[model samples]
Target chain A: MAGENMVGTVAIIGAGIGGIYLAAELGVAGFKLRLHDIDDARLADVRAFGGIDVEGERGGFAAVELATSDLRAAVDGADAIIIVTGGNAQAAVARSLALLLRDGQIILLVQGNTGGSLIVRRALDAAGCHADVAVAEMDNYPYSCRRLAPARIRPIVAKRWLQIAAFPGNRIAAVHQRLSPLFPQAVAAPNALYTGFTNANAMLHVANCVANAARIESGDIYKFYAEGVTPAVARLYEAINAERVAVAAALGASVPSLEEWFDRVYGVREASLVETCQRLTYNSDGPYQATGTPSSLEHKFITEDVPTGLIPMVALGAAAGVPTPAIDALVAIVRNMTGRDFAAEGRTLARLGLSGTGVAEIIRVMNEGFA
Target chain B: MAGENMVGTVAIIGAGIGGIYLAAELGVAGFKLRLHDIDDARLADVRAFGGIDVEGERGGFAAVELATSDLRAAVDGADAIIIVTGGNAQAAVARSLALLLRDGQIILLVQGNTGGSLIVRRALDAAGCHADVAVAEMDNYPYSCRRLAPARIRPIVAKRWLQIAAFPGNRIAAVHQRLSPLFPQAVAAPNALYTGFTNANAMLHVANCVANAARIESGDIYKFYAEGVTPAVARLYEAINAERVAVAAALGASVPSLEEWFDRVYGVREASLVETCQRLTYNSDGPYQATGTPSSLEHKFITEDVPTGLIPMVALGAAAGVPTPAIDALVAIVRNMTGRDFAAEGRTLARLGLSGTGVAEIIRVMNEGFA
Candidate 1:
């Protein structure tokens, strides 16, 4: 594989579960690795342990070639910098590496919200730094994992499939070729817009948490997708999916409905969205078995989903003349419920530097790749 | 008082808590009472008991005078007809009385949704029953009471105040004069629009039920407002309140904020909305203390609230160019959760015969009252 021949130093940013597991897999593939994060305690644990111990199905101790709190040293000679944090951490990570980024250092955001690349690029530009670097995002991480301890990670499941798109979308093949060893089932996505709408994390989680809010905050442990997404909540997920699909249509991007997303991702063949969700949620080996209901209404389902998920969709739908009542409704509820003005603070087109641009311009920018 | 001298026979519809209590109070006030309902079992109990045996601080037996399942016979020569039931049941009662209603009879809907009058008016007109019946509604029921048995209604406390309005707007004073004996502290509302905006049951219940969905479904028995309205849920309630206020402003109507409503009603001078709610909810005599947390999301909190409370609000806000994202979102959530099309099926401008009208026309209709 080209990824093997092209193997070189790789910097894994954010010492989260994804970062640790990614490092283990890539280390097993024989690439020199570096782990970086602002979490000093976590970094110290990684430093003390000398590397991450990944368990569950794919168990291994990947020796650390380097572990550092320093961002520059992490990427000094790396072929690529893989960011494995929530979209919430993307901008901060971007700013952290703004002045330190180098030429030919590709940056990839695993399961980024749309505009994540633009944000990093803008940070570099603001720092008066220019480099010959390619940037990309995946529709999802290839694994659903969590940290068992600061030095250990549990790879719950190898998600089997992922869609990748490069900013300046023409680089998908070249980028995919170099990244294939780590993500064996990687496929080329049409554009970031496609990946953006198709990112099912927020789509499924937010609606389920909101619909089953009582259950989630009831202090009872429950499976999120199985117990939270009753037949009724499933219908909401469907409507929200329809709105996302409509936004894609407005942008001239093609993606599967949320129902089909579950089908494609988990490889389940079911007649309805609820049935498919029920199956995936209850699967013992699946990632959701490791997930629990958010303790209250103030968790990531509202915090991450609002700003990154529904907010941009609502704004884009408004700009595209497609109504997103369902998305807008959730935004309002969370905004009021949380005292956060997500609409004012979220990932708007203006924030993404695509304000006042039409659909063609957006699609054109996505495909042509920015300089 | 003029209401005492003007009192004649009165028909009490629905035979629920409010209906039974109203019968008891008016029967003590020396007016002949007719308790009418389609509920044969409840009606049979009322008939066998011959009158209601009331308990609590206000204790005594008040003769029913007449208990019947026959709607026409009950209202044959009534001075006024008081319909006491959930807002969801209002339409059916309207249709049942559509053809049988006579001239000069005053029909008061205790806490009927605004559309309740419009629907009954439309029903009467559709039935070719052109009569001078004055259809009216109250801001809320005059008591926090429930039926212990079919023959017994325990009114925990008398709601010291109520605001009355009639459909034709001009008939308010006459209706008030005839109906005020049962509602001693009743005052004439500027219009039905004011009363509609101030209906707090849905706004508080829906948000609390949704935010505290876990606790309710967990089989915990608690007072709804006191136990469920955490700071976050209180914020959602405030948003919903703001949206309701915006809708009223669009209609040129003024209503108290939910916070003030609780203050005025409960006589608690609490500073925060949550604190006020907590106090009122824990007060043994407060209306809310009489209410229990909904058993499930499927209860009236979502079902009745979304349709009767939020659907009309979203429609009115849209027609008036007022953005009601908070109300719209709750409607979407509940609609999907219940598999119901509340917006399409619930009260709307079209249903209220104000579909294509602009803001000025809406205000005009609200002030002038529809004939």
Candidate 2:
């Protein structure tokens, strides 16, 4: 049915790099588009340009059907909604969508950031919006992109593979059917649990960032991955990744080791994780090349990732009865460094509405509905 | 009294900076010295020079009665045995002394790195030595010195104050009596627990090393304290110090906060730990100015300090039921960085012969002996 009647009108929220890329691709592909961002300046640029200019990989002056800062008008009658506001804004976006969303609509988080769907679903329930909508998430953004100008985006490369799944995973088939056209590389994941655990960025960013805390603060310009991920740092990555894999296993989710993921995804056939990172840093034209290390400890690598990435993993590990000592230690250290208690302020399972639930119940809720 | 009849003969172990500095000072002070080192080359240099050439502050041609590679010959007939072989060599030195030591000879660890006295005493007991020797420890090396050549050293500066304590709290007076003549600034601590917890080096080294791990590995030459102790890194130091203070409190050992210690010891008054470190680094002629950042993670900042310093602190904290989450986290991170399971390989409470004991028992042992 999804193949027969490909959802025509699409709502793209958050005019960030990912959101703009999604809009440009879908708009050029003949799907009607409405783009929304809380930043009026960005929306004004989009409106003035009449649409976004796409370059590299995909090229077109993709016109939008609607560009507005209005939340309700953006998704007024769209068949599908793509949220790319990042993990920090996920809860607020979810709350706004809860009131405007109609029945038979689909919501997808561009990158779930470890339990994005569950968090959005919980926010929807809390706001008393019980619309018959399907919520889904991808492991990461489909494109590595940058905004050249206000309304100009360069999509450097589209990811070769991604995992997509809906909350209460039974609905993944329907969600995957619709998403596959836009994301040809996406394969249906068993559930959001699979997608969440496969978030390699969560495991990768924090430790390396912490390891290079002084370099970042010293106002020195250096390659984050190339210079930062030394042998010891790479070893830390392996250690943290092992803990992550154990937690995933305890939750009945299968995930690749960080080394395996790097090898499989990047085609970096190095002897160790350290070599893999070094190879990817110098040789690849991927996100690693485009990315800059955080300017301060307050940057997203710690501020956003600690709460959305590590804290959630720690909470999930605790609920699953799997020890995440390395991850837990990281959270404590970050807390000390920043004077912020991530466990208290972060995305705990309780905040995601999975409190008092054991491993079996968590897996059950993840596969089935919250009911 | 100690002043009435001072120890006339002293055995100096290891020919490192601390050993050479001790030997030079005591030899110039007119006490007979026998210096021992496993390295025959260093002994050859000392023999060739006819004695150690001392420079800076207290300069003299300090003669050694004997400088040999033989451990038994080093300690034979010496009234005081000074172990300056560093923490790594503590166990082997203790075992060797167990066989060679005689009655009424005092054994002192130059820098008791958080339970050094206890570990040495345990080794002696395990080796079945029942000599009436008082095993004592000082909080840190008395002089911040460097060796210019074999058998030649420059005493940078004597520590303004140092804490000396015996294994049992009650024997401190006797140890202090002999030690004070050599170390005029030395004061009596309640017990080795007080001296151990007051070890500011262990609290300061690892976290800052980890924060600048990539920099250290990159082989970039920089001042360790000035460039490395950025704001976030200083915050980590404070957090670790807090944990150390709590563990000390639980064991009835009082120690200064890192900030307080900086002010009291270095006379660098500042608003925060960050400012204090910065002031000391740029303004003072102390150890911070002279010490270079480690070339690799395998340096003593991680390798030597972790096992002998942090591991013991964590063990003591555990015995006292004090949760050292930050310190424990630092240990885990260091373990990850170095590929060493510090908790397993480094000192544990059980390893120090303090297993199956609670807070009250630990404090009791600190005041009393193993009996």
iRMSD of prediction 1: 2.9
Scored against the true structure, residue B50 in model 2 reaches a CA lDDT of: 75
In CAPRI terms, model 2 is classed as medium
Q: What is the TM-score of chain B in candidate 1?
A: 0.93
lDDT of 2 by residue, A126-150 (tens): 8988788999998877766667887
Q: Which candidate is the best by DockQ?
A: 2
Candidate 1 chain A, which ten residues in sequence have the lowest lDDT sum?
A211-220
Candidate 1 has which clashing residue pairs, if any?
A168-A369, A214-B213, A214-B214, A215-B214, A329-B329
Interface RMSD for candidates 1 onward, in order:
2.9, 0.8
lDDT of 2: 0.83
